[model samples]
Target: MSASDWQKSSYCGEGESCIHIAHAAVDHTVRLTESGDPAGVILSATPHAFAALLDAVKENHA
Candidate 1:
């Protein structure tokens, strides 16, 4: 997906550390810090990889 299409995560809840995500064009998901401009560097990964990352974060937090 285009970087222009990514929206900040709703879970961010007005925080500065939020991340933006988009699935508007490509099958791969893109992520970037909300504090950066839309043109900022983005990390791309498959949905499964992203899910695994989330799971790892949850596990670490728990």
Candidate 2:
């Protein structure tokens, strides 16, 4: 997937510590930085796994 195609999360805005995510077909790739560096480390995960992570965060915060 192209780095330019990565979509920033709606919750992230003008923040330096925010993470970006890009959809590669049915999988999701997360980027630690938005410097547009080709060497950026990308972590891939399934939609279900990502959703579960979000749920865990919400539960933990609650």
lDDT of each: 0.65, 0.61
Highest TM-score against the true fold, candidate? 1
lDDT of 1 by residue, 1-62 (tens): 35567677777766556788765344555465455356554666777887898899999999
State how far residue 24 of model 2 sits from its true place (Å).
Answer: 0.9
TM-score of each predicted structure versus truth: 0.61, 0.60
Ten consecutive residues with minimal summed lDDT in candidate 2? Answer: 29-38
Evaluated against the true structure, the overall lDDT of model 1 is: 0.65
Clash list (residue pairs), candidate 2: none
RMSD of 1: 3.0
lDDT (tens digit, per residue) of candidate 2 on 1-62? 57786666667767544566766664444433453443564566677777788899899999
Judged by whole-model lDDT over C-alpha atoms, candidate 2 comes out at 0.61
